[model samples]
Each structure stands twice: as structure tokens, then as C-alpha cells.
Target: MAENEPWQDPRLPEDARLTSLEKRLKQAQLEDAARSGRNDKASHKGRSQGMRILSDLVGIPFGSALIGWLIDGWLGTRPWVMLALLFLGFGIAVRNVLWIARQRPE
Candidate 1:
């Protein structure tokens, strides 16, 4: 148990200890990177999904309503066709959002 008796110790050599520490450090770093990578992927997925939901929710309805308005103008249908088509667009958008949500991975 002498303080300066490391060389005499019947244990791992200094190089072996250093190598073991290096291995542990490398493993820990890899594990940390893997954990952070998973988190990044999860967050990125969530953000992208939110954007997709927003787009599906807004874009489809807007496009449908615009088309409906154009058709109404061309057909001289007043408000009847335009309103019906707008509601149809909204319903389709809702259905799509629900379908997309259901398709998400657990």
C-alpha cells in the first residue's frame, strides 16, 4: 500500500487502465450521441408533422374554396354551389387530417 508502489501492484498495468478508460469514454460518447440523435429525430418529426397538419388543414380548404368560387362565377350559381363546395372541402380536410393522425407511428 505504499503511495509510490504502482509498478509493484499486482493489478492492471498503467497502459491497460488508460486503455480501459479510453474505451469507456468512447462508449459513453457514442451512447450520448445516439441519445441526442434520437431526440433530434423525434423533435424534427414532430415539427414536420405539425407543419404537415397545418398545410393539410389550410391549403386544401383554401384551394377548394377558391375553385368553388371560380366555378360559381362561371356557372352563375350565385351562393348555392359555392357554399356547398366550401363545406365539402372542409369535410375532406377533416377526413384527411384524421387519416394522417391515425397513420402516425405509436
Candidate 2:
């Protein structure tokens, strides 16, 4: 682009050439920013999605187990409900993880 500059034309005054160069510089900076902004947006989007998946994978099981334990204590069922719900929660977490993996972008 610099090699193809009209700023080198002999008819153009020095001020005109300077202004053209400044404009080109500003344009180049804007292009750079545009490219970086796209990359940053993609990166942030992927990161946030990963964090959400991680939270779901961890949270659901723990919440399920806690509820199961509380229910068992209230019903005097001891370990049965807790064990069943613990496995159920684990299955749900695995299902969610697999779903997320399957739906990921290529």
C-alpha cells in the first residue's frame, strides 16, 4: 500500500501527503482493532461457555446429593435415597457433558 501511494505524486503538496499518510495510519490501526476485537469476542464467548458447562457439571450432582441426603434423613430411610440420587445426579452430569461436547462448533 505504501509503495502504491498517491502521496508520492509530484503535484501533491507536502501537507497533502502528510494528511494522506496520517489517514492511512489511522485506517491501519482501525483494521488492526477490528481484527483483534473479533478474536477477543470469540475467545471470551468460548471461555464463558466452558465456565457455564463446568458449573453445571459440578453443581447439579452436588445439589442432587444434598437434597437426597436431606430427604433420607427426614424419612428415616438412611442410605437408600442418598445412594440412588447420587447415581442419578452423576448420570445427569455425564449426559450434560456429552450433550455439550456433541453440540460444540467444528
lDDT of each: 0.78, 0.81
Q: Which residue runs of candidate 2 sit more than 4 Å off their true CA positions?
A: 1-38
Residue-wise C-alpha lDDT for candidate 2, range 26-101, written one tens digit per residue: 9998899798665456676677778868987889889989999999999999889988998899899888877876
Instruction: Write one digit per residue (lDDT tens) for candidate 1, span 9-55.
Output: 56644566667889999999889979866555667777777788899
lDDT of 1: 0.78
Superposed by TM-score, candidate 2 places the C-alpha of residue 12 at a distance from the truth, in angstroms, of 33
Q: Lowest summed-lDDT stretch of 10 residues in model 2? A: 3-12
How many collisions per candidate? 0, 0
TM-score, per-candidate, Cα-based = 0.60, 0.59
